[model samples]
Target chain A: AQSVTQLDSQVPVFEEAPVELRCNYSSSVSVYLFWYVQYPNQGLQLLLKYLSGSTLVKGINGFEAEFNKSQTSFHLRKPSVHISDTAEYFCAVSPQGINSGYSTLTFGKGTMLLVSP
Target chain B: DAGITQSPRHKVTETGTPVTLRCHQTENHRYMYWYRQDPGHGLRLIHYSYGVKDTDKGEVSDGYSVSRSKTEDFLLTLESATSSQTSVYFCAISGRGIEQYFGPGTRLTVT
Candidate 1:
């Protein structure tokens, strides 16, 4: 079984400052990683995903995440943040090579990014 | 934007009352799922459907039940609601890839 852990409960950053949100997962088999962002009273939006090939995955809203297989970590980073970026971020993982019909994603508790001016 | 919609976006009910939430999708995806979100717990899967009339329980499925009658509609039923069941419920549809598209969510309150 696979599980995810978002190390930080909340991260605060001023506008134009860089920010990083840490995530770790545990799985016996290979897995696919994803990042999703949720705004206030809204549903989750796909930020990015790492299926294979590259460790660094680019996402929407100028966000990116690096997957470190050795450490079982996928950390999201952004060089500059905006006040609109204040929202909750979730990290999820799915067992690799699984069919979409039976695949399920295990999600982390989430990290709230607070971007202020 | 996978053309998913959740009905009764906000609801309030008394304890022990039965409630049902509806999810409709236009994408005609094969997989659908129901999840509840609370503070400190990002999202916990309650149930999922791989096809019409085919459903399975998830990590937190004790107090919830789900049904998918048609390709586009998935229904979640809470028989005898409790205060602990109050939460924001989200419905999702899986794409050809491993990614899932989410609905706007329904905020349920049990009084």
Candidate 2:
């Protein structure tokens, strides 16, 4: 079974400050990583994903994450955050599918990013 | 918003009553999933369907049941509502990959 762990429950940052949300996963088989962001009372939006080929994957809203295979970590990062960036972020992992049949995602508890002005 | 919609955006029902949440999608994606979100728990999958009439359980499947008779509709039923079941439910669709398009969500409360 694949499981994801997000170490931080909440991260408070000021506007124009850099931030990083940590995520780690445990999976014996090959897996894919993803970061999703959710605004207040809204559904999750895809931030970025690491399928293959690139260790550093950039996503919407100027966010990016690096997949470190040895460390089993895929941490989300931003050079600077805005007040609008305040939201809950989730990290998830799923096994690499064989021919279109893939397993469901295992998500972490999520990290709340609180950006202040 | 790739044509995914959830019915009864905000519902308040009494305990022991039956409640059904509907998810409708126009994208006709092959995969549909139901997940519940709560404070400190993030989002937990309850059920998913790879195709019509083919459903499977997820991490949090107890007290919840799902049915998918058509490609565009997936229904989640709570047999007997409980206070523990109060949470926001989200529906998602995907096309055989990690990227999933999510619905706006339905907030359900049991009092």
Candidate 3:
């Protein structure tokens, strides 16, 4: 079984300031990491994903994440945040399943990013 | 906005009543999923389907059932609504490369 843990429940940041959201996961086998954003009253949008290769993956809206295999961490980072970035961020993991039909996603509790101008 | 739509965006039902939610995806994806979101719990998968008539239960699937009759349609049914089942439900379609596109969500309140 795979599980994801989001350390912070909420994070507040001023516009143009840097922000980091921490995420960790537990899995015995290789897994795929993903970051999704949910705006108010909207569905989730994929921000980025780390499937293989590069440890540092860049995503849309100037967001990036570093995948640390040894530490079992995938932390999202943004050098400068904007008011539009205020939303709920979720970290998820998809562990390799027995077959292609058995894959599942395990999500964290989510971290609400409140960017104030 | 991956051409996914969930019908009856908001619904209110009493306990013991049966309710069904519909998810329609135009992407023609091979995989579809049903998930429920509650306060502080994030999103939990209720069920998923890999192909038509092929379904499997997830971590939280005791009170719910899902059916995929067509490639673009997945239906979620609650056998008997309960207070604990009051939450926002989202339908997702899996795209290429392990990415999922979610619906707008349906808010169901079981009083």
Best by TM-score: 1
Screening candidate 2 with a backbone cut-off below 3 angstroms (N, C-alpha, C), the clashing residue pairs are: none
| Least well predicted 10-residue stretch by lDDT in candidate 2 chain A | A97-106
Candidate 1 lDDT by residue in tens digits, B1-111: 789999999999999999999999999899999999999988999999999999999999998999998999999999999999999999999968789889999999999
Minimum summed lDDT over a 10-residue window in model 3 chain A is located at A95-104
> Compared with the true structure, what per-residue lDDT tens digits does model 2 show for residues B1-111?
589999999999999999999999998688899999989888889999999999999989999999999999999999999999999999998875657788999999999
Model 1 ranges off by over 4 Å = none
Supply candidate 3's per-residue lDDT for B97: 51
Q: Sorted on lDDT, highest at the top, how do the candidates line up?
A: 1, 3, 2
TM-score of candidate 2 chain B vs. the reference: 0.97
* Docking verdict class for candidate 3: medium
- Per-residue lDDT of candidate 2, residues A1-117 (tens digit): 988999999999999999999999999999989999999999999899999998999999999999999999999999999999999999999888654634477889999999998
State how far residue A79 of model 3 sits from its true place (Å): 0.3
Highest DockQ, which number? Answer: 1
Alpha-carbon lDDT, every model: 0.95, 0.92, 0.93
| Candidate 2 ranges with C-alpha deviation above 4 Å | A98-103
Task: Report chain A TM-scores, every model.
Answer: 0.97, 0.96, 0.95
Local error of candidate 1 at residue B23 (angstroms): 0.3
